[model samples]
Target: VEPKITLTDKELQAEISELCKYAALLDDSQLEVQVKDGVAVLNGRVASSYQKSYADLLAYRAGAKEVDSRGINVHWRHTNPLLRAQRYEKVTDEDIQAAIQRAFKHDPRLLSFEPQVKVEHGVVTLTGDVGHLTAQQAAEQDALHTIGVQRVKNNLRVRWPDEPASDEQIADYTRAAMTRDPYVERHNLNIECENAHVSLYGVVDTQFEKYHAEWIASRQKGVVHVNDYLAVRTKWKPKSDAAIEADLKDKLAYAFVDPDNQVTAKVENGVAILQGTVDTWYMWQTALDQAIAAGAREPHCLIEVRYGLPSGPHYYGPHDYVPR
Candidate 1:
């Protein structure tokens, strides 16, 4: 057997301290780090959930074998001058409508559907017919991301062509689409179709695969709606919690653009709990994807966005955004 390499407590604490110094989300003055037998324990008060998570990730990356983050408390309000002065601006209804139209016009997936948008007191109502359910959902997502929009009412209808595909044909086409897509092809998925509505049942390794399967079904020739009942099943591997945490940290650190922004992750039984703050909403999403790709079955996100900054969280409506 090969000799096991381990970090001394002093070395581990020093490494974690250095990571926290570079993390944009963590408040070093309020944090206390401790390590024993390669396990790191973080004690501190963070302004947001994102900071709490970042602290955990920093410790793991610094060579801690296991992380205990129970000592970190998340305080919703921040005392930072920048965060305190952030104001919510009210956007006009006409602006919201214009933004929605622009979003639809720009996205090729939604260009075919000319959905009527109406906004009253920040609530947007979409009324139109589209060729596919995905298009209808895309329109709703556009409205939600518009500034000052509070809620969305998606009244859009999916109008199947006169020569709609049969249920059997729809199912077959959906399976073919999934198989063609390299990301979703390897998983064993069961597809069932009724009245052009597809239902998927299976176990995949990541959330990306689960949702990709649905997207494939929705884009099929005659799919009405996709019902996803898929589950995430991580392949069993003998990995220490510390090893998994370090791997996740490396992935996020390399991909993340903002050195100031910090994100932390904890793993238990294949589940990753992510917490911290990111500079932008796009970064927030990227972090989640990286975590899932690093073998996290289900990642619990407590990441917070510092609004009012140049790189802050963007508003997302009920339906998630679908890129063309």
Candidate 2:
């Protein structure tokens, strides 16, 4: 078990700032941190919402009980112009590829696997074999979230070590895992396994729980793929479509400093549909997150990315990146 972090507020503020500085994506963010009690507040401008997420993660790692990152703004054009050209410090495809390899080395799930990496422009491709499905997914996530990476092509194959477990054994193990997990244990989930493919069928309270169930199912040995069919149960009373849309718009405006209101939210039959254009994947993701927080369960995002660079081929869809 990891030791409990008990840093003082002042020390935690410094620690978070230092940690942010060490991250490649946050190097140019110039973020400022303020800590009071156990809450850490971050204020600065970041190029992408991914960088803001990384900064928040660092704050929590530095012992902050609650992270207030709303003060930090996401500017699609926040990078230093000189650093991209005159300073000769722009991140290259080779740099991104190397960073991903280092990330894999640091990741406990990927330390034992050496997946082949190839980069072109800002796109990365991972092609190799891993002993489990989790490692394969981790490889893709690491590459996809890396700074300067626009998209990831995960062609990595998952090959189980030794003999693959029988479908019955796989289901038993997955069901046991769900029982052991605190998030989905009491949710009365149903699991089925066929040819090493795990299927999760149940209702979770939130998207986090739904994803957590799928995550646990995928970790089982001999599991090749997880088909997540878990539905999110709406705990709150149903609201009218207009009410939901109004709530979504209010949440988005509060979450972002979008003067032009690049993203729009609409509701149809109690479901929220987000439509608009944003400059980067992070903005698009933040819109979805805000929609869910505004009581739009399983919202459909129809937002388009307006980044100048050409997007990678649609591996899962037409979007630049798929939210895990």
Residue-by-residue lDDT tens digits, candidate 2, 1-324: 542447788877776765564455565677889999879899988899898898887677566788999999998988865543421246778777777776675566886788999999888889989988889998888776566777899999888868888777887788788888888787665455666777665456789999888888888888889878666756656777787888888888776676554778788776677788877555665776676667765567677765421212221335422121
Q: lDDT (0-100) at residue 24 of candidate 1?
A: 32
Distance from true location, Cα of 71 in model 2, Å = 15
Per the 3 Å backbone cut-off, how many clashing residue pairs does candidate 2 have? 0
Error of 2 at 147 (Å): 2.6
lDDT per residue, candidate 1, 205-276, as tens digits? 688888888888888887778878666655656666677778899997888657678888889876677778
Instruction: Write down the lDDT that model 1 would get.
Output: 0.68
Q: Against the true structure, what is each candidate's TM-score?
A: 0.48, 0.54
Give the C-alpha lDDT of model 2.
0.72
